[model samples]
Target chain A: MFEIFGIPSNALFGQLLIGLINGSFYALLSLGLAVIFGMLNIINFSHGAQYMMGAFAAYLMLKYSGLGYWPALIIAPLLVGITGVIVERLFLQWLYKLDHLYGLLLTFGLALIIEGVARNQLGSAGLPYVVPDELRGGQNLGFMFLPNYRAWVIVASLTICIATWFIIERTRLGAYLRAATENPALVRAFGINVPRIITLTYGFGVALAAFAGVMAAPIYNVSPQMGSELIIVVFAVVVIGGMGSILGAIVTGFGLGVVEGLTKVFFPEASNTVIFVIMAIVLLVRPAGLFGRRA
Target chain B: MEQRVAEPIATPEVQPTVWRTQSATILFVVMVVGLIVAPFFTYPLFLMQAMCFALFACAFNLLIGYVGLLSFGHALYFGWASYLSAYSAKAWGFTPELAILTGTATGAVLGLLAGSLAIRRQGIYFAMITLALAQMMFFFALQAKFTGGEDGIQAVPRGHLFGLIDLSKEMNMYIVVLVIFLAGFLFIYRIIHSPFGEVLKAIRENETRAISLGYKTDRYKLVAFVLSATLAGAAGGTKAIVLQLASLTDVNWPMSGEVVLMTLVGGLGTIFGPVLGSFIILVMQYKLAAVGEWVLVIQGVIFVACVLLFRRGIVGELANKLKIRL
Candidate 1:
């Protein structure tokens, strides 16, 4: 019966939660992109397809193998990551010396392959994913109600983001990866295998997408198209946040998500386009993106 | 005569060039004849569809080939114009030519806006920006009333051509579509061979150098983008008239990808490549419509194969071998 700004609080809170959840996925995926772009210099167009694969993997694990959410969460990413490694070692490696556009085209082909296969088998309709028993309840915070699974997604993604930031920005292995990204020959001279590192980095980026996929399956539908639309928005986010800094990707992802959530509260029609509008503004003001340095 | 000719430049490829020019002329003549005679052996509607797609791909090639920019969201202009033309012909009862003009102009204006926005970023970023903008338009079409949502603007009339030639006749409509496509194709060819196209190629090859050469590269790019979009819109409008429908599929991202695929398969930079590629793809799609997603897989394979082995594409490679530009 209570209203905030002449609107029902429950609807407002619900949209906010949805926005936050979507933002969490965006943050995770963009973080992966930034990390991969930092070292591998590939935009990972198949990131969305890999995300879809992760969700499908989870679905298949539950359907065919009796795997639960917990196990699939771990298994799906690893499996997807292995596929990423295979793609990198076999096909993607050939594109390193060419224009970056080739990488985009190659990954686009890969995405089509993955999505097409999934569509062939699964059809375009969505399959259901159940929330884990452990994360089934909701907590009433008076101002807004928080579902346990959504809260878990937010916490887990933030934790992962922070951990990834720490690993890349603070660790010794991170230093070598940075060195290799800056100068592959210097890192190779130091007895580091840069090719393996590039492959693993791609795998890592793909795994990040898979993890987001696993997280998203329960919140949204597990469908072939789950990632394609999300990927475009994430691209806009990357453009807005800049692919330069890891921390920038994280902050901008969450920030845009919140802004989108607020837009849904006020003017619902523009909610879908707010991110793009912001990207346009960012382009006009700072073409390099918010956290990106001039190329 | 001996004092003149100040050391004639040595050229090693005159025979090949002459051969290619003859062959190209023969090929165009054959194409014209085939299109004119196609209705006798095959369904006129199918040929019209193929021509529409060929024009679309040719329009797409103008940007990627001449301007050196690859757009991922060209469906916006194509689809939007189809909707406009369809609406005009159906609701406003405009003649077919007028509707097509309206669609093309709509495409040109949208292209101007999108090109202005997308040209801000170079290379892959430009591709992504155009895609995102197109996605925004897709969402708009989905919600907008005139687009009719999932059902799209159906039962669009193939109005008379200038109140004289009835377009309801299959043969007549086919001719109209063919004429529009050929005109658009010739226009693109003219643009590509012109000094303006040279400036676009220069910008694509080296933007910084072109800028330093006292040319405003952005202005040239914007012009190229608008021209490409206008032609693409013309194709879309013709398609709407031919098919008598314009749906979401026309304007979706996948359709954009399809155009890119058509251009890539035909040859990215080749003049006549997209036309051949579009014909092949349309034939394949019509024959394999029942096979479901395998078509996508095959298309993807072709994309990968083209990128890796046949980067010049079917026409581009042939042109290269013949030592003459198409």
Candidate 2:
């Protein structure tokens, strides 16, 4: 019965929950992008496609191998990350010395290939993945009901994102990774395998995207288009956050998602474009992005 | 005379300037001759489609090739122009040329807005900004009233050009399209070959150096971006008039990617690359239209192959091999 700004509290909280869940995915994906760009210097245009693949991987695991969500979460990312490692070794390794745009172009091509192959094999219709038996219900939070799976997504993505930040920013291996990102040759001189590290870093980024995909499968159907549109919005997020700061990416991701959710509550039409509008304003005010240092 | 666009990825052998310019002129003449001759043998509608795309690709080339700014969202200009042109011709009862002009003006204005924002960051950021902005427009078109949502604007009349010459006739339409394509092509050539274009190339080659040398590089880039958008607008408007429709396909991200593919396949910095690339791609699309996503996979393979094996593109390689600056 309560209202805020003439809108129902339930609708407001519902959209906010949706927004938070979406923001968590954005956080997870953008975190991966920042990590990859820091080490590899290329925007993984296929990150979205890889995310879709992860969802599909989960879908297929359930259909073919009788694997549940719990097992697919662990195995799908590993399977996709292994492919990421192979891609790094075979195709992406050659472009490290070239212009950064080449890396984007290459990955974009890879994305098209991956998505096209998937669409060719599977129709573009959404295929549902049932929520696990245990997490099927919702919890009442006084104002609104929250689905347990969505709560799990928010919690799991937040945990994964923080864990990634910690691993890259706090650990000794993280220090070496950052060192290698700064000066690969110097890092190599210290008896560390920098190329191997770069490969793993890329694999890890891919794995993060795959993990988000696994999380997304139950909510949004396992469709080929799951990643394509999401990736563009994520790109806008990257521009707003700027790839220079890892933490900036996470904050911007979550912050923009909440903003988008609020926009959906207040003005429905602009919801599709609010993030882009924000990007334009940010470009005018802070060209380097909110968290990014001057390029 | 400097080729900075594809130079970093692949080092092409440079030829003597005098011979390169002469042969390039010869090549231009040959293209004009071929354009004049091809309509008689080919389907006029398909030819017109190819011409519009060729112009679009060439306009795209002006940015990527000369300015070294790879705008990944060019479909915004191209698609918006088509929509406006179609709406005007169908709704406002404007003549074809006027509708096309309205489209061209839309492109210039949009370009000014997008270019100013995108030029703030160079390289990968520039590409992403343009793309994100374009996608924003795509969402707008999908929701806006006049665009008619997914069905788009259909049955747009091929109104008379300049309120006089009829364009409904196939040959009449072909000639008009030919003139527009040639004029746009020459306009781009003048832009790229002139002092303004040289400054653009200078900016592309090295922005910091250009800025330090007292050239306001952002202004130059913004100007080039506007010009490119204007030309792309003209092409899109022409396409709308010729095809008698404008749809979401024109405004979507794939259309933008298609333009990039055309320029990349033709040659990034080469003069005739986009023209060739557009024709080749249109032909491929025409043939492979039935196979579903195979075309996308093929296009993606081309993108990968071009980036990996031949960044210079077909025309680029030819220019390098023949020791001419195309």
Candidate 3:
């Protein structure tokens, strides 16, 4: 009957692919969050808005500049990254001395402003972005048909995630970043421009979120409200992964996505809430998160 | 990565002087009188709605102000309580008091579960965990049969209070809401000024020191969390009964943000601040109802302005300038 667990093989594989796609975004977004949190000590609550901005940047580019997907992909993240630089320079700089909660609150306010402005302009409905011409078709694997764009999203996200990990874990700049996160005074004493590094790190992290947004534009509708709920899911993923190690963020992201995919097939109703349920359990058992250093 | 504590409340150990007592009494009387008389001047429903939010904001203020725990998911308690109470009132033929009590109890139970999980982590993690849990409950509400799937539990009968006084009469319902609000407000005031409140303040100032002082700081935080949730639930139950409906607006993240905004605008630690904040925000919402998303923008602007320039908030600044606590 080509059935596994009373579900068709195609349907099962299809949902798993969807889950992997979602997981790729989660890994990219969470990686950015961890990197930003590492350097700035701010949670960057406007991250979702920045992700939404990336999609909007692509849309605007295509509309006016007649830019295609690839060009928009490179340019959109740069544009959104510039905005993140502005945000860090203006509002976020003042909050470095205050409570961590203030950063969360301030960025939350920024998120609201960005989303609200977008909604006011765009009218809350989703706008469709065409899949790139090169990645428009699908391949019929023996078990399931996989769309090229979605597969591209997965591969591209994974590559970027690993590249980011390599940069942070192996490179000298990432060493400076890890050092700066631990002690800004020490880093400053070493004659490195810590403030500039902080600014750059925030920008880079935001760029990562925007990059995910551009990739997501084809698979999901580009809307003002798109990143709002997705951001919460990412938050749960962060909590599960512990936001400590780069690899932790990546592994947890994909793992949970597969688990969610399985849940969709088996339980269906819990598909929306399974991560949260797991989050509660993890919080109860290991409050430090899976990869977080025990305090 | 950095873990810095919130700013401490500059409590100067208010010595109870005779002048202070007289002034406080007079101020309290004037406030109660203003609230009573003001309803007649403007729309009564608006004032009632203001009172509901006032209670909600005050409940939220208790945790952030005293314990330094910013719960970003308070809407779960408020909205779920409203749903349970609304369901009981309309479907189960429960009295108004019973229904509201059901809602309040629901908040307490939820607080116990969420608090235990959240209190494990300090600062930002606490906020995140609470938010995640609240979102979880929100999904549950969205799908569950009793929540009416987005249309929400509508046209809930307010029924009668204690099976005698008819709540259908607007004046009667208003009085009940007013009395309930006053009771909750005074109850919160007592909690803040009590010895327990002092320990909560001590913990806010330095949690490790409080722990070293032989106080089970976690228990104190948990109790305070439950009390705040219960009060918020009471507020929500009152609101559902007054509005004759319970909807997703009550349980959404935006609703939680609005409560935080109200609390921030009024004053973080001041007893009278949340009520003032609630009135201001409620009026703003009513005026901006036509502009739609612009309200969100304005709220965002206020949040930024408050965090950046007006950290002490309206009442906190006034208290600072006047050299007296509100």
**Best model per lDDT:** 2
Better by DockQ, candidate 2 or 1? 2
Reference-based TM-score, model 1: 0.96
Worst 10 residues of 2 chain B by lDDT: B1-10
**Tens-digit per-residue lDDT, A104-220, candidate 1:** 777888888888899999999999999999999999988778899999999999999999999988999899888998999988998999999999999999999999999999989
| lDDT digits (tens) for residues A130-225 of candidate 2 | 999879999998888999999999999988888888998899999999999899999999999999999999999999999999999999889998
Model 1: runs farther than 4 Å from truth? B1-17, B21-23
**Candidate 2 ranges with C-alpha deviation above 4 Å:** B1-4, B8-21
Fnat per candidate: 0.52, 0.66, 0.65
lDDT of 3 by residue, B85-112 (tens): 9999999999999999999999999988
lDDT of 3 by residue, A1-295 (tens): 2899789999899889988988898899999999998888788788999999999999888988899899989999999999999999999999888888888889889999999999998879999999999998999988889899888998999999999999999999989988998899999999999999999999999999999999999889899988888888888898888877999999999888888988898899999999999999998888899999875
Q: Give TM-scores of the second chain, every candidate.
A: 0.94, 0.95, 0.95
TM-score of chain A of 3: 0.98
In CAPRI terms, where does candidate 2 land? medium
